[model samples]
Target: MRAYLALLEELERRRRGNSLAVYKPYDRQAEFHAAGATNRERLFMAGNQLGKTRAGGAEWAMHLTGRYPDWWVGKVFDQPVRLWAAGVTGEGTRDNPQRVLVGPPQQQGEWGTGMIPADAIADTVMGRGAPGALDSVVVRWGGGGDVQAGESVLSFKSYEKGREKWQGETLHGVWFDEEPPLDIYSEGLTRTNATDGITIVTFTPLLGMSDVVLRFLSAEAIQGLGSSPPQGGVAA
Candidate 1:
């Protein structure tokens, strides 16, 4: 029947959308994500719309849910992790990091269609002040025959909330989807110090030569590196 065929098509689309096997990162993205294994700090500076956020989001999903693909050569956490993903403001955070990690913020049922696999999403807590935005997400780990292993946590944050908001919690990782103020950036680093956790910053260098940007550039210069410090970018 016509209706039955339509339904089948929809189901197929959802199946493809939820599968991590469909993700194929380009060479630069692969290197960026892989650096987390040895680097405590990383910066993915690129032009706009070059898939920087997408690459970062996918890696965060893997860390939070322990759902790395067999081809994954990135950082692997032995246990469930507590991570924070942030942007410049509440709305920006929801639109960028939240959308990439989960799904469209305005869509209710399509939440698990993003980089995070549907089966790995355990639950979500709605954030304050932003409608349809998630305050945090709980991800189920250990899918290889041990579904009861543990749960990882991913929290959404914003730089507009100030450095004070970034304080008080020791986290396993932090993903900055936009350029953060220096104070906010410093606080985020401090939060992960106890865990020796990683901080991944993915942003276009619109605010050219800011302290955070300079920090990475300076490091590269001091080390006389051929590649960009932390990771380089590809053209959009």
Candidate 2:
């Protein structure tokens, strides 16, 4: 327990090194607190600029690397962890975990408060550019030892094109950055194969009724609701 707490503090310190400021102090604190909890699912519902994505990114990094504190509730995949980091479109992925997953030390402003551990990335990982077809790019990460970029087993795909590939491969985890089609999430979760793999969904709510949103709110899933709809008007 003591070691886990120490590791958690170290992660917090590294997270704070980012250039962006926390938009909501209370919310930021809440996320940090929740980040340490052992719960498999966490929801951060708040207005924009409240650091929800950043919180998710930080936790995702921990999951990717299997460095989560021992006391944390989140599941840690067996290394080499196969991961799927997606967005509504391929373009949106460039700024989020696409970079952070294999980013440099001086975390860019574009990554916002989310920064990857510079030492953890491999040259081969970055060199593996997005395959012309979204399904072509495979990505993976290592923990407890060094992982070469060429060795990244994880793949990057969009909601539209990778269904076949997603269905074929076994994965360690999935991180959906923005709301993805409900069917994609459903199919993707199955790919993780429960060999004790995990799936994480992070995004600001949009159009209120997306299938992914409904699944996140489902009683059987790792539920969360975060948004800043106009006062008196319900979110779509």
Candidate 3:
């Protein structure tokens, strides 16, 4: 059928690295639903093991690398862009979304084969394995100073800090992982108004009545929610 043929073509395009990772219908819908509106805030709610973290990680990776593919606007980041990639805490960044960003070994089915490899990324964002490369691929930035890597330097922070040190700074992008508190998200967003970049918060909605839950459930926000069989044989 024509639909299946189109799907195959798109898959081939992705294989050739000509497109961003393909989202499921619901995920794709959520992206469009959030992008179309002008709301300063948007949220995606779903059960665990869903692609919420994937969506955010993918977008953040692309934007930081200045590699905005189709269906994404406002992602052309300025060089050495100030970025803060955070989770529940520093260790959490070493987990979910950050793990994806850094290219840990494939986890069977959770990420499928679509996840980007750490090596495949340009030297600007990740790093090239030179003769004297560091032990790990981790790059550091921040604390009233900055790192001048070819790619944007993203400092990892914890949601527990609230608005304390996160305020009174300018940023080009901010990514919050796994249900960061609403106040932290708000404060992070304040730092991300450089030119016209974006602030991304990605998480599966666990608690039913949180402010984030309300934000996405509100009539105007994109609504993507449901349950699916676990991927990678893991509950996520």
Best by TM-score: 1
Worst 10 residues of 3 by lDDT: 227-236
How many clashes in each candidate? 1, 14, 1
Which runs in model 2 stand beyond 4 Å of their true positions? Answer: 1-46, 69-73, 104-114, 125-153, 218-236
lDDT of 3 by residue, 1-236 (tens): 99999999977655544224443335443553346235444554456666667766666555555544565553344454556777785556656655565443234222212234332343323222222211122222122235344545555666765679578878776777777777887788778665454566666556555665554453432243323211111110
Candidate 1 wrong stretches, greater than 4 Å: 1-7, 10-19, 146-148, 219-236
- Model 2 has a clash total of 14
Of candidates 3 and 2, the better by TM-score: 2
Give the clashing pairs for model 1.
127-135
- Each model's lDDT: 0.83, 0.51, 0.52
Top lDDT hit: 1
C-alpha lDDT of residue 57 in model 3: 61
- Lowest-lDDT window of 10 residues in candidate 1? 227-236
